[model samples]
Target: MIYRREIDGLRAAAVMPVILFHAGFSFFSGGFIGVDVFFVISGFLITSIILEEMRDGTFSLAAFYERRARRLLPALFLVVLCCLPFAWLWVMPEEFRAFSDSLIATSLSGANFLFWFKSGYFAPEAGEVPLLHIWSLAVEEQYYMFFPLLVMVMWKRKPSWMVAVLVAIACASLVYSEWASRVFPSANFYFLPSRAWEFLAGSICSLVQSKGQKRGSDPLSLLGFGMIAFSVFYFDETSPIPSTLAVVPVIGAMLVLLYARQGTWVSALLSTRVFTMIGQISYSAYLWHQPLFAFARIRSIDPPPLIVMGALACLSLMLAYLSWRFVEQPFRRGERRLLPSTRSLVASVSLVLAAFITFGIYGHDTRGIPWRLPAPIKEFMADNDWSKTCLLEGSSGWDAMPIENCIFNGSHAQTYAILGDSLASSLTPALTKRLDGMNIGLQQITHSFCAPVADVSMVPHQARDCGAFNAAAIEYLVKSKVKTVFLAASWKIFFEQSRYIFNGEEVATSDVGQRLRDAFDKTVGALTSAGIRVIIVYPHPRGDTEIAAKVAKLMHKGTPAPTITIAQDEFLQQSSPSYAYLDDPKDRHVLRVDPAKIFCGREAGRCDLARDGKTFISDKVHFTSAGAEAVADEILVALRQDDIMDGNGVAALSSD
Candidate 1:
């Protein structure tokens, strides 16, 4: 119920790391914990206010809601409103619909659930999702919607039972968080059921303060600061959220609240003028940063440099200060308050809600307003035929895609198959059609993110082991007596973006290179031992930004047919591991296909997103149907030159 400059300073602590983390700073990989910190702060402040109001017999749900509305809604609505023109100019149709979905959900206080449902393997990258951060506000709003009611009910029945009720619910939520963190990690991360414990931790902290401060000391505050700092520096994305691992930060926040009193160094540090200012603007800072980052990525032709990203991060803070003053202050502070009464606030808020909801419905139903772009740019994205065919995301692991039409019909008893992750499946449709003329039926087998390797897994991201997926593919191929297998994946991603494991223990970061060497050797060995020929479909040329969206954004702004170009040397550097290992396999017959050569060779040192006015690379590494078809032509060339498939390409089909 009392203002604490230290708490505001604590807000400064929570918001900066989140902005930096979302800006792709690896040092702040655990920066997402800032949201949990915010949860604790919110629970404590809101609960303290409610309990105090109840004690004075002056609590009104209508008044409480009006305060929440004034505090949160106006600034949020302004941010969303500003994003509209940018979304119009930049975001592609399907992506725009998703943005619209978030818009509607955010307006309805359901963004967390929408995001959880939408966060599949194919979800857009965090930088491309403009309203992604709104999910946190949605979570907090949902918490308040229920938490106050529970507290009120408990207070009416018996004042002492409120603390007990909070404790019991918190314990149950903690247990659920631990169990769900392992089993339903995405759901656990986004939804309220698994996150209630973090809020309840703050609720209990409020109750303790109410009873009276017995032993507030600097040591406890220092320990709390130490715990918060430890979690921030020591934990990473691999850490299960809000599990026992998260209790450190939650309890740390509680300790800080309980003991960071006047005269304590921690309190003094948190109560600084700069920290309170940053804290005062923190909510607006959080709202503004995601859109700035997302739009910057969407609009840039190349990956925006770290310096540029840093500048944008600063710009967000500047914008936050303005938003806090102009949009947030007027609604809450009352000197020049636009809505001075609850009636006026309700009417104004309802109208804004209806207008935004209508905008969301209109934008979504119009499919992100396709008519806003030239037909050529619109057609270019719409013509993604391979995107609809034999996609890795469409398959359950190791299941044979019913592509009997694509099977290789050859002179020999053995047949052919394609294997890898989604990248492999992207090639299947184009490879299938290319070989159809040659009567070579190619069997299609792939899975999402399932690197076509053996005996290793990307432990943090993989729900099922990639090793198992590859194992099943190898077994099926061997049993089917396939003659040659073409292995493909986003090799650059596996080598760089993922964390690896061998034999159930994490492969040391230093040892990942050697572990991958061993895995590739085993994979090639198993197939080669079966008398099956192998062709490595090396990773395609990668663009720094999502290419299609970037091009569309440029075109909408009257830039003529812009393209994303990456240097060949840079591609090789990014993908050196895949190139070196797969290109010069120990087995001489372990052949390879290079997408970099096909995509990058034309521009001397640089690779273009399209060739001959045909767009190919879809996002970063995946291919368009036209691009896949071009790559298929190269595969055919390799087969003929290597004398694996005869130059005279006609053969009869065999059901055997």
Candidate 2:
């Protein structure tokens, strides 16, 4: 195949937005479509190459694979090598193992399937791994493995019938993508079958361009570029992806490829040195950017500022250029005189096998660190032995347990009902400490992922479990003499446009606020009318980055012990703008607490190792047994202010 500067220009078009978007630049939200564009381009170019070779009877499976290895492996191996020191130093034992396995998966060209089963592409866990982007490369490599053979067979049997076979395969891939996107979104996003249609779109372009007719005039190419530009700016992460909606980018890419011939303005513009330079190093740029961003976030426990992110982008480009020049170009020279094809193939296969063997054998054993803890902190985390604690009914089952477990157990314990979602459950260890110390009996009930926001407008997934669990818990409260009901959960997840109705009704537009207020009133009234007081518990401030990153940093530092810390007021300030989506519901019945002041450090605004010479928390969010005991003073103050707790803990105690 002859070189086309326009093709390189097209590459620039596809990759720049992807780099920008992944860099956390808001202007290129839809830039993720760049992957789809690349898929199409790969399909067209590779298919064209295969078809030409097959026509002349020069197509050999060995040769095809060699070319692919030359094109892909050199740069990829270099990337994995560069990540070694960082993975060793910065990543935790568990994460290091996962990264090692991902490295093997990438080398074997099966990373796509591995990632699909492991985590969603957008998942914080998956995003943290340096090799996450290798899934796309795996998809392409897997495609080449089968596609060349299929084309060769069909072309030999019937020269004119290959198109029909490819069309059928493309259709099948599209169907799989559409179905899987709904059922297994993570799988749908990563796998080759779901992604093949985009490539097939490009393959069809190869057939079209080969027919000796130009696609259209300059107007069509300009229109295509316009459509692509619009999509890149407007689309976002929330958009249902790799589904029918993906046609926008696929179509735009086809148009640009088909009509971008010499002398056209579209071709002239895209073929410039600046754009062409970006295209040449596009592959390396894609590989380098994610790990850099992820590592920065892991180290800081916060995303870098835009200025810092921009600097990283510039650094990525420079690294990409170096990789392209030194690593990629040198390895791609298919000079059999120096390194025979057989030897090169054996070496590549050996490297791939070594990576796989090492990862598989060592993956699990990598995290075999011993758990040694100080006597006190160890007691706090593991106290109330799992064997002895009144294990709630159905806690082991898929069905949710009631909200009664949030209370304490004691002779004089008051009637305090606990309710909320998983966030609420995570807080149970801390809450239990305070209530247990106070000699209070507790009844805790909670449903997984079901935050206790009464407003339908706030809830997401319109989760049936939330509605059912709350309804049953309310019924229990109405029948019992519960004096005070304590409500706690991750409130931010619910109170936003993120709400999705399972019933399929669009959010009620005119009365959304009123409806929210009414729901709150009904929820509160059900308890209060039954002579029960209500206490709303807001969550401690949290960083948006994955929690594992924070834990891993401590592990890397070889800490003698774990520490508990609260986010600073300044950190809270940084997060507050996102909270406009979360409307805080503070009523006379609701008692709010900003524990950061008492729990966090004075200067850093972080939860300190010790507060006033007293250890306040065990970990970042959960309070230590001692910390929980200390919080009894604050809990009492809030309860007294709300007049929910009586002089004696009798009514509350009896209710429990």
- Candidate of highest TM-score: 1
Query: How far is 491's C-alpha from truth in model 1 (Å)?
Result: 6.3
- Residue 194's lDDT within candidate 1 is 87
lDDT of 2 by residue, 457-561 (tens): 233333544555566667777787666677665555454333334223446334355554555567766776777766665445554332333433543455434
lDDT of each: 0.80, 0.66
lDDT of 2: 0.66
Instruction: Count backbone overlaps in model 1.
Output: 7
Instruction: Quote each prediction's TM-score.
Output: 0.76, 0.71
Clashes of each: 7, 26
Candidate 2 structure, TM-score to reference: 0.71
The per-residue C-alpha lDDT of model 2 at residue 169 equals 86
lDDT of 1: 0.80
lDDT score of residue 494 within candidate 1: 76
Instruction: Tell how far residue 59 is off in model 2, in angstroms.
Output: 3.5
